[model samples]
Target: MKNRIWIVCLACLWLVNNGVFSQEVSPRSVFSLNEGWECRPITTVSKKALFTPVTIPHTWNTSYSEGTILYDRKMMVYQRPLEITNAMKGKRLFLYFEGVNSAAQVFLNHRTIGEHLGGYTAFCFEITDQVKEGENLLEVWASNAYRTDILPISGDFNICGGIHRPCHLIVTGQDCISPLFYASPGVFIHQENISEKEAGIRVETHLSLKNKKEGLKLKTTVTDADNKVVANSETAVTDSIVKQPMLVNRPVLWDGKKNPYLYTVTVELYDGNQLKDRMVQRTGFRYFSADHEKGFFLNGKYLNLYGFCRHEDAKGKGSALLPEDYKMDMELIKESGATAMRLAHYPHAEPMYDLSDENGIILWTEIPMCGPGGQAFTGLVDTEGFKENARLAVKELVYQKFNHPSICFWGICNEILVSDGKKFVEYDDPIPFIKELNGLYKSIDASRLTALATCVDQSYYLGSSDLIAWNKYFGWYKDAAPSASKFFDDCKNTSKGIPVGVSEYGGGASVNHHQWPLAMEDRADSHFHPEEAQTFCHEGNWESFAKRPYLWAKFIWVFADFPSYMRQEGEVDGYNDKGLVTQDRKIKKDAFYFYKANWNLEPMVYITSRRFVKRDNPLTDIKVFTNLKEATLYINDEKIGTMKPDEMKRVIWKDIKLNEGRNTIRVEGKNGRGFLSDSCEWYYIGK
Candidate 1:
């Protein structure tokens, strides 16, 4: 039975992948280079270089000592033995690295082939002339050391070292679609104009030709969700580029979370009659805009973006994760009823973007120009090298992710200011650089908008980007909870009208700690982050955010706790506990259900403060989070009063008496779809 079940699961997975953008039939042959690699860290006074067998999707930070923030920021040398066959002699061979740390240098047969500066983006190196048809040595020297030129000079998250993402060996025809253009797929599909009546499309194919020959033409085809060809065109390959335009009448739109229809794009290069190279990708036709007085609109409809900011790091894996891990995270996000996600601090793995496209979850992806938070200082510098590197990183981010329709906003930076004695200071003027990045993104793709996450109270970079969001922590940091609305109003009352948002809000949480009266004091940097405090912070924050439509989007500070080398104040050190869910992806905090009850349409009844099992006060309030209209409270299986939830989906029974010993607390509710119930036990010490 187990074997049969496994086979069924495999079959289902194959069906799903085939239904999506996986290539049906392709001429290119791609191989995984993820296994059997010997790694060693370079040292100053080395006695012996003992290499350890490691995998491609591996990181050295996983072995860091627990409760310590220090990671081994050394240059790691990974070597692998490759045997080239005679059949692959005539084909163009390339090595593609999805991500390597801060820098990487590739060597073939002890000779340097290529080097890349940025870490979070993808890059490829051609190895056609460097290899023979026998055993060859491939070496990659990866380093994560702090560099002044890198955009993220300082961030709250750790810069994990090693080859943290996948690497592939691609072999294709000599005259085929080039994959060397910043490691992109060499094919870009543009939704020139989209509407319910007609859709305009332009397909650009980048080619690598050996000779200028006649009868070489490119064919582009678009297929709808039902595998029906919607539009098709052909154009001659001229000067290593082919552009074809087509139109579809009465097109099906890719709406957000409503329909999310998609169209498959296939580009084939043919020399007269024979096919040479083929590429397959997915794209959707949609239009959106952000109005200052109004809110975000998608496909001529308003969409209030309420989601979470996510970091790619996990508990044991650090930033190195497999495709399955990303898929799991996507499932969790969908389950929580989120319509959008903010890929914060850095560009995540490619699978994350693909999942967003497939699941129709809007994304706000960004580059790694993260700013300093606490003791860390330097964010932006006025050096030529730093400016040049930042320029390249922004361009690469825009070009590589040009075709993903799910990405609607390009975030330039996050919290780009340093604290200076109760005031924040920007030592170097960041407006010029911000304008440069904003212009670069618009030059590449003008369909989407650009955003910046600032921590300063006012609209400092107001005209720098298309939108501006303040990362304010009112109740958790210093001011009272109700002050958030006043702050938003203050920003709106200013002269310039710019689309505003709440980029980061909420407080830290630890499941172990519990307080009855809910400590209203500020403990932003302390280790006593009770679970109730996080719940209270969200309850207040959402109350203000829900009533204001001018606030375009509100992204919770984080979706899951992540590793931060500078943080040492939580249930465990070296982690930021501001996430709605734990780092291991195991437990969802009480605050997680609070948002689920309000945002998700699925019927659910969750008893908050269940982790606070031991209670000293016999008379306490019973709070239940349920999307249902009304829920009934039962104490020790006895009948209690049924109450309706408020506008925030919160139902509370005030001052309920409990048994002296263990008391059974349960809440049952139902919606039009189905019924749900949740139960927990609380042991009363004193009665």
Candidate 2:
């Protein structure tokens, strides 16, 4: 009878594995801890009531109206408890958080397990040891009380509290791959001297493995498009420990636009003949360099850089988005004719790196030290606090994202080293801090170039970075609206030998929604005119805002505004309407169309702004912004004539006729440095 029972159990297991019980299992599970959370003053907690209900992605202080709030508020403490059951016993358990504002201390079953100090960057801790077979308790204590030691305490943007992102309890195999590791197993490249047809190809492969005790083994086989083996090799490892420096040679070459060849590298791990894990990395073979005197080069060919800064926030969800959202953003970025993206103030969601790797978009990833403020503001200065936070950010960012081929630059800060009035005290020189930060970045990721954004004149700090990038608001933030040409000239003149680029520009605009006549008085601190600010409130129009700058190949900063609590009186409460799309993700503003015209590289027509068309005006004069140097207009296929835009903001196309039937107007612009086109169709009743 015991033998029969064992046989029945084995049969049941087989059926379950083969889908007989598939309906009972799922690919993923949602564990929502949004409810049953509570918060109280930190001073009120006692030993007996150590655990309390608290909401995640929450902050300690919600009282500040605007500006930086840097006071020690120990009175407020947040707590949350979770109960775990036996189903989570043997499996590897991971507590994953998208973000925990400021610093957090976590306890499981009354024992301290893990702690994190950074507000951004996703982190996880294994909790299997702390949990029992039956009921288990999880407690978290979060503090947003300001500390001079924290790096972001001095910068712009509100340190909103609570778990700003979703939390998850991941359960996987003991050897499951880490969520953020580069998915590409490894990359191969072939670099040939242009003069010599017989070029040597180099192959490099990387893998994230578990069960290192059994050792990792790499097996590489290269084949042509026809599946014919051209070369192959195998490496055996007797030890499982991962060495800091891993290297492999003779990789296949990946070239930019001219010769976009790529090779595949396959790596596998083994534990005494038992297959442990496997991964494949696709890489290209090419050695490129960027220089102050010569610009950027790839495979010995000189190329200009054209790109934009991207934020991770999505419509409706705020910053809490899934992998698909990142993928879609990349798709639109690629379609916009941008070859690169600066991940903005911080390292972006992990999936962004994967998309950049696959799509070949160059990346400039940076830490969260954005805007101005330093020791003067937080009394933190360049002390241990700054060093520790910088070190942690660099280590995590490099370790998790270094392998992506698309990552070409690592920025230390975005205009933070300089002293702005917002700080409590001022320093005569910011060069020392800049040098220290740049040195730290170089030490961490020697493979990538280092850069920073400087709002103040940085002639003295130019030597600190490999490339000189400045976020000049001469036209936007500052009162002086310098010509686009003059702006580039100013950067060049100030940079001297250093290669200069405009990292941020463009004014904000709201879409469809006209600014309240009182908006100017209400938002006195805004950089652009009320009408211009309204134009950016939609999608596509923000693209137009980026056009003139892209002509030089190094301008970015076309943004879809991020949500911030730094609102002044008379402003909208929840959303910052300067984004290409509204916070809710509806309405594509006029600037979005301008960007689509310049970046899409296709013939398209879009309406920029309708404000000029008053309620009583039936015929609205449209200002079509195109990257095309020369254009010809055709209405219903009838050749209208060559067109040129005049200083008065009108495109001249003489003697064009219109009819009552559905009519189409197309204008094709000549492509100079970038592509540009636009069109419009109107129905005529009787005139």
Candidate 3:
């Protein structure tokens, strides 16, 4: 394999003493660096690949195989010019990249500034000493090559390379908030004795100043949703921080999905009564605790978390998604009545956290230190210096997302031993690695708890974290329902310890594949993965989950089908078809509505297998997932007696005779508040 780097910026014109700007723009300014970037792969053999235009938050994998992992693991070089004036002589300038994956080598004026490992976290470089008052070159080399030291060691997802996230140029005065720590907001809010009546909030602000300045004051104000000031405090920047407390008489609680009220906290820096810098942060007041016996209690209400895990990949876009994509995904999850979500295996884009906050959806986010040895072929080998890389990823994930009220738990690891059976080499135990990561998380933020996701055969490791989650595929893999009852019975008797939950569970199915007779046995390894099998698996799993009130949370394996290179079992060769929704997100599988019927409070009725139109049976067991108590079924204009839903919210009408041709089946019912109606057309051929 040949290695090369592209000289992306062919001609970076510099500002000539430069008349571009008269005065040094504004003090402490931040500008978007999304434009004027030209890039080309090092293997470019023609003028077409010679310094082509590209944008920030881009990926070279856009042109690669969307259905599988045939992505080109090449290096992409990006460059842009920065215009500086004489007024910025004393101020410090910094460049911030929200995320860049496998690795990034940053340069200024053709000199290497620094390099960052791990593609999912934010990093910044201080360039005040290297930048000039005119045009300067800002070049970066990014790659998605598989390395021995990065996490994901191996997973079912595609890792694309580029400056795949937003980048910005930040300018700050000598006395301002510090952007040194993972490019995070310098302020951290700590709430104590939190409730509706009264609460205490401590504001911790870290500042970076050029010199020892005098008469610098930090003013803080807490405002509610109505823009009314609730609490106010101000103090001098005697040191690098101004830690103070603000007490409110009555606070509005940020209840999930019910009422997601948010409050804005603004911080201002003043030098001798002149405002120097300002930062506005949004947060909400809420408190939650989990019990293995009572499930999760948020703001003194038992709110069961019926959620699903989400991946950041999209069709043809790879990991590079727009704000509109985020909104659409958020709306879909919200529409499914998912009260919580697990940002699986890694930290998602920052915008997702905000979307969760706005929609009142609880989040369980984690670093990419997942599944034994990180990637494939290691069989549980932590060869990538996973502990250190994980340390940095954890720091970035917590700090950048600390203020978001939607975040409920921090995941330390996921199925670290899922491949423990394939261990071909001797390796250190993962128990200590997970424990140290948990300790590191505790040292920074104690406001939230940390959890670990593990597959079966790792229950003994549950004592390492604040919470434990298991990814079991009992029905799909073991040909039976999940052992949630045994798990709860074994762990629920404890006094007050870690709570348990189901992190990943579901059978895979392609939207186009269907099993007419709904055979539920000996089909685990079937190449013709059927949509009906996925529906059956979900029904049994939900039935188990509904009975076990001791379980705290349940995050389905995935919400959408995602890309995977090594996957060949499902109908799609290069994708994981475990998602409840299709890869294109154009159709929701029957399993999606199974959970909706149980979780959604709205009056709804839907006949499962509406997409399984072709059938070869005279007698069919028609199933309708409905919140309605009693629903009447009619086939070919003939009533089939009204039936009440079972405890699982399912109305099953068995042995329904179908017509020779297309048959119209309709179901109508009324719930506590409204009426529900559903109809499906099925073509019946001779059995």
Instruction: Indicate which candidate wins on TM-score.
Output: 1
Give residue 562's error in model 1 in angstroms: 0.9
Per-residue lDDT of 1-687 in model 3, one digit per residue for the tens? 122222322222223233232232325788889889988875675755569788888888764455444878778888888788887788888898988887899999889999999888888889989988899988898988877677767776778788888898888887778888677888888876788798788988888877677788888999998899999998977899789899978888999999998999988887765666777899988999888677888899999898899998778777878888899899889878999999987888889999999999999999987753233464235555666687888998998888999998999988666324464234457787788889988898887878887764555576678888778775787557656556555655542467888888888998789876776665444677788888888888888888876678988989999876766677756678889988778998988888888887877888987877888878888999888878999888799889988888888888888889999999999765766788989898775
Least accurate 10 contiguous residues by lDDT in model 2: 182-191
> Which 10-residue span in candidate 1 carries the lowest summed lDDT?
17-26
Per-residue lDDT of candidate 2, residues 2-25 (tens digit)? 999999999999887764654422
Per-candidate Cα RMSD to the true structure, in Å, reads: 7.1, 8.9, 10.0
**Top model number, lDDT:** 1
| CA shift of 55, model 2, Å | 11
Tell me the TM-score of each prediction against the true structure.
0.94, 0.70, 0.90
**Per-residue lDDT value at 172 in model 1:** 85
lDDT of 1 by residue, 1-687 (tens): 999999999988877665443343556888999997988877633647578999879888874665457888879889898778887888889999999988899999999999988789989998999998989999999999888887688888888888999999898877889888878889888888899999898888889887669988888999999999989998887769888888988988888788777889999987765677898888888999888888899999999898999998888898899888898899889888888999988888889988888888999999998787545576788798788888888877876887888989998888776334356553676778888989988888888999989887545687889998988887899787778998887777771888888899988999898888676888777889999888989999999988888887899988999877788787878778999999889999999999999989988899999989999988888899999989999989997889999999999999898889999998988767776899999999984
Regions of model 2 farther than 4 Å from truth: 1-98, 142-145, 160-266, 277-286, 373-380, 417-425, 428-430, 478-484, 494-496, 512-555, 567-578, 611-621, 626-687
Winner by lDDT between candidate 3 and candidate 2: 3
Candidate 2: count of backbone clashes, pairs at least 3 residues apart or interchain? 69
Between candidates 1 and 2, the TM-score winner: 1
Which has the higher lDDT value, candidate number 1 or candidate number 3? Answer: 1
lDDT of 1 at 264: 93
